[model samples]
Target: MLDIVKQWAWYDWVMLFIRLISCFSITATTIQMEDYLTLPLWVVVFWEIIVFSVPWICLMLSYRYYLIAEMLLFGGLSLYLTSMFPEAYLTLLTPAFLIAANSAEKSYRWSAPITIVFLPLLIVLFSREIDVFEIFPQIGLAYVLGFAFHLLIVNHRQNEIIRKQNSVLEQYLTQIERVTLLEERDRLSKDLHDTMGHSYVSIIMGLETLRPDVASQEGTEKLDSLLQLARKGMKEVRGYLHQMGSPQDTLPLVHSLRQLGEEFQTHAKVNVRFRAIGEEYPVGKQVKMTLFRCLQESLTNAVRHGQATDIVVSLYFEPQQTRLEVQDNGHGMENWKDGFGITTMKERAAHLQGRVSVYSERGEGTIITCFVPRLVESADEIIRLFIVDDHSFIRESLRTILEGQRDLRVVGMAEDGAQAVELCEELEPDLVLMDLEMPNMDGIAATKRIKEKWPGIRVLVLSTFQDTEKAKEIMRSGADGYLLKSIESRELAETIRLVHRGGTMIAQDLLHKMLDAQSANEQEELLDAPNISEKDENSYGLTKREREILQMLSQGMRYKTIASKLYLSDGTVRNYASALYDKLGVRNRDEALQKGKKEGLL
Candidate 1:
């Protein structure tokens, strides 16, 4: 009953008020007419109180059956009173309207027919003393108003449901956008690492090889300058890759803010203090970003404009909003206008239905407070991984790369596949990254055992081999993905996520090689059989373009040379060669040649 009262809306309170007034008036009238009653006056008054109190108790307890019973009893009481004193009809109007409205709201089908029959019967009872025409219209109007109120309540509930659904849809869209942005960042990072990093390394190596060959002083000086430039470029590429792979994108609001403060303190050579108040709560990415930018801008202004040496950053997580307060101990401005940075911060907070306030004096430094409305949680489940590799350096490097991702955690590492299988049983990691060329119990055997025991766990093979047979074997052992050690760090991280999401991710080049091997094996088997027909000659499924590429490969023609002769691009020729390999069931050009000679196609 108390819980129901706590959840009552304004309409419920209004109904309660109306119910109270009607009960009091009816009881008061009963007292005034006690002398005309046949039963004892006290007995009638007590019965009246009990009858009125039942509806209130029913409403509170949400007992619909009892409330319906009370309605029937009240109707009988009203009919009895009208018989003794027709003037009692005036006191009955409010109670009749209340019953009709409450009943209709509960169920129109049950209440509508009841109201139509009961209200008119009451009117017919009053028709002896009052005109039937006047009372009938009044009763009709009450029933109409009660039905209208029911309609309004239904419409309000539907609107609430739609509003909640929209809120959920918006959150889903925001999450999708965030994931897409992170994937694009990783793609860009991988491209830079593969292209620019390789080019710089090559340039540095060639320059170092020619350094001793330079005889003149000027030539040596030039060579030395080139070496320095190449090294600098390589260093910059490494920095960019690190920045792109940073955990800032996935850190919680509090951790990200603390990191920002520490970075600011280190670079500005200023003393900084950080503190948080209230229980922390998860917030959306946009809200976090808004607060982050506000703190960043405040720190900059404190140093540049206020010349503040010491700074204090305070974060408050309240029920309604998340707040940030940045105060400095430097000189402050008495009459400061809104600069571009301050305006931008205000706009960002305002976009999230929040606000930014600034307070500054001549000597008290500046205080900037930003408030953003609390949003949805941004935490995701972490994926545990086990690494199986032989080299210590490779194991540590893999750990570092995987740990940089917010959702990925390297829980265990092993030097060989045997150790990996043992630790995996104990750790029960979500995913395993294994190398095929391990010393004891190679990756293929370990993978097979793991899948047999725990089919829920995913296995990804990260090896140096481009060997098609090994890839097929590991895959048959139930590895979810296969890739080479030459894969970019960013790509490796993304692939781990994809595989964890129940996707199979095979390296593109490895897939091409596997297809080539399968095609060659099939063609060789077909050609070795007897009773060969004209269709058997083309059983490899090679097109004219593919056949030409295969013949060029037989003549020791480079892809570039073949493309030039065939009036095709280098990429087109390579695609033709891949197709040719696929049709011949071969892994490489050499395999294709061996099969072609035995079949007399070359």
Candidate 2:
């Protein structure tokens, strides 16, 4: 009963109040006529209480059959009392209104019949003492009013439901928009890092090398100026990347931390020591950022706030969690409180289900420790790489650079395409970093043969050529990614990992050229097949999947590459291609492409 009352609307409370008042008035009026009653007045009052309380309780409990019984009892009592005392008919008006209202609220079909049956009884009872014409309209008005009230309540409840649903949908849309913005920001950051950041670093390195070779002082000074400008640009890029929350995908966690410590030692002129207590392991991007930020904050505070001369940073890797501690030998704070940096550090740690704590004393140094659950990558998650280039120098250089990374293992090296194919058969590396324009068999042919035999092995093209035609050919030959030889070493390693993980990487400029060529070809096909009507186009009845397969085939993509791009199995791609061939009435892929072009379906 309490739970039901808690759920009641204001109108329900009002109805309960009115029903109780009417029950009390009826009881009081019956008590005043005690002289005419056969039974004792107290018994009559008790019986009246039971009659009203039972029906109201049934209504609260939603007992619809008992409500019907209550209606019958009320009608019999009103008729019997009216025969005994005619004035009692007047007091029954409130109970009649309640019955009509509740019945209509439950169901209008039942309410209509119930109201009709009660109307004649009301008229017959009232006619004995008063004119039927005078009271008939009032009785009808009560039923009408009750039905109208039911309609109002239902309308209000529906509106409330719609309002609540709209609120939830708006909140959902806002969350989606926020997520999309973050994704776009991350993508922009990566693009800037891969393109502008790499270019700037290469420029700085080139300038540094040229500085020693310059014979004239003027030339040396010019190179120095250029190097400074390049360094400044790189710094700005790094700051922008930090603002965008870019992940350090290229370097391992330990290397990144060591690099950070080295930078602070060089720039701040403060002694910063870093040590790894346990066996080093890979951690997730969030954990890396949290630890990096905590170290950065601790170093800055030690120099600027604590006036520290030396800082020691320790990283502990455990089975369950990872811990980072930063201690500074400087005058500590007598009273410590969280500022913006410490608060942000705590929030970042908390986001990873971790924590950050600071311990400080007046004379002793301060120690800031962060504890984060270890989200370690598998130890065996290494990319077994094969290098294929005609030049021995290129092959050995790539091997040295890639082998320096913890996750990359150079398993084999091949001089030319022919040797690469033979060695691949025996060695079966996870990825092949193939160089285009090789002697005898080129990279494109070798890639095709390898994909035909081992469709799972990824092939990434590393070449000097940015020719659109060659890129298209290599893609069609089933190469998973393409990169320029001028790409930064770190970017190259990251791209290799990305490709090995079923992602495609292409140089931005080359990708733009390929897209432009594709658009031109599409326009030319449309112009040539101007007479192809919409009905004829629909006649092919190609499904969305079939159309996708056909378009990729037109671009010379092999079955395995198409399957990888679409996240489907090679056998499923073959089935779709076969269906497309039959629908086009073609014997092979070349015919399908030609027919598709003529029909303007590419």
Candidate 3:
């Protein structure tokens, strides 16, 4: 009813073989009547070879289904006809058995119509038999039964083979999905590590600028402790994602350009007080990317080859354009021959329609200036915001950023978390900018208070420390969000709104920390243990860039250091430390230094 005849399975082939053997065996049993079947013997021998031989030839020639049909046709015909001439040709039973064997298979469809037309011939053959119905009727029945047995074998084998193939295919597909998932996760890790690493360094540096505000002797000790803690965090961060490091965002344009004469003064250096002409605005993404790279190349050259400690970084930002000049009192490049670092720097400059000029001589300092336009657009009006930092400079700086936005208006500002807490009571603005380590009251204490008092108001954490768990704990205290101040200003601004709107924010390294999804102790013992934090990065004899890298890695820095230190974005500084790690024969910084001392690298 459902046309199952066309849906025949491979089991039919087994039926064909069984039928052939059975019919052939039937004729062998009639050997005693050989003389009685003498006439039929010649016909049986001649056609037996023709029927079996032709089908085999067709099979060998690749007519697989055609051969199946032929086998069915000849088997059926010989069985019917030879039964009438039983004594005449007993051997004909063998061919009849062959045809019946495969008759159930779909391949025998062609034989179906032919067998119908041959029914008349079948009647004629049966008519010659005396009492044919009574004698040997079970002979044909046995042939059919053997074919059924063959069909069962075929069905079983074919089903087993198909089931095995399906299993293999499913496994292959699952493997592909796992690979894709891993690749996506890696990509996200690189992004968070790169963008947030530089941001953390800058935040730490900015926090260092607030050391003067710490009033008490106990506070000073805490400040020093905090400073060490912060630097250690930075060092550890460099270890993991050292390759994906973004160009040092630590030097906010103004810091890199001027007022740094005394910071590195212990090292003996000249100063360049290059200041902006008017109100200096932050550069664009493309320009920021270029300036970062150019400065990196200059810094690398200064630290590595510039013997003269008198180095000056001058940056002048005007409304229309921004100019960066890095001057040093050291031997400069003698020839135009460039290495990969310098070439890379040049390529980045070209991307922004900018140019870089270098003037250098032996025993003389070098001056590298990269000039690019400071294209300004009116700030977007995204959301209203407020900031509370113990450091006046930080509060003022963040306030300026929020105030600059046409849409965002700072309702109020506070110097300490205490004042912020009080302000939250009165102002009750949309969001609260809670600095983690604040004077009088810390962000954690203030957040606990605010959440208890005004749970609706969101607290966005701004901190330099790598103790992200501290942030997590603060979030547990009802703080709505957390962010390291070193993050891109735009990202910071965006994260605030997202958090205020009920979204959680995390530092880039948080993902790396969570990558294993195991406890800290378990992570250390994991198979193929992924390098996590940088240990003893400060004690390591790494130069500034390398030290910066170690700090990032130790703090769970991902492979975005290339983007941080070198200013390459997207796929920039990935895999930079893999070979370095191998050469050091150490898995991480602590081991690298221990080994380095053995090799006199210390």
Please report the candidate that would top lDDT against the real structure.
2
lDDT for each of the candidates? 0.72, 0.73, 0.55
Off by over 4 Å in 1: 39-53, 60-67, 90-92, 104-106, 119-134, 201-223, 242-460, 463-602
Off by over 4 Å in 3: 1-382, 514-602
Q: What lDDT score goes with residue 58 in model 1?
A: 75
Clashes of each: 7, 0, 56
Using all chains and alpha carbons, the TM-scores for the candidates as numbered come to 0.46, 0.51, 0.32
lDDT of 1 by residue, 1-602 (tens): 78558667666777778767777777788788778987787877776776677777776655365447555766666666777777655544554566555663446566555555565567466548866676656756776775566566667766754554453334334433654576567556756775787578668777888978999999999999999998998999999987886355568888988977886676666677989899987765456767877987788778767877789999999986799999998799987666768866765664444667888999889899998655332247788999998866678889998888788899999988789878988998999999888897899999888876877788889876567888888876778778877576665876676567555556655665675777788577657756444542546655445666878889999986775576433434554665456456667989998987777666
Model 1 collision count: 7
Q: Write the per-residue lDDT of candidate 3 for residues 75-143, one digit (tens) a residue.
A: 454554456554433333343344444454474565433333343245436656534453244345544
User: Candidate 2, residues 1-602: lDDT per residue as tens digits?
Assistant: 89668668877877678778877887888877889886788877877777677788888766475457566655555665666676566555665567666763446566555654565466465547755665556656776776677667778777765654454345434534654565567657767776787688668766777866899989988888888888999999989987885335446778877877776676666689999888887765546767877877777777666767689999898897889999998789976766667856765665455667788897698999988765432367988999999876678879999998888899999888999999998988999999998899999999988887888899999977578899888877888788887565666876676567655667755765776787688657656765556754556656566787888987889987888787444544665676567557677999988888887787
For model 2 the TM-score comes to: 0.51
Question: Rank by TM-score, descending?
Answer: 2, 1, 3
lDDT, ranked from best to worst:
2, 1, 3
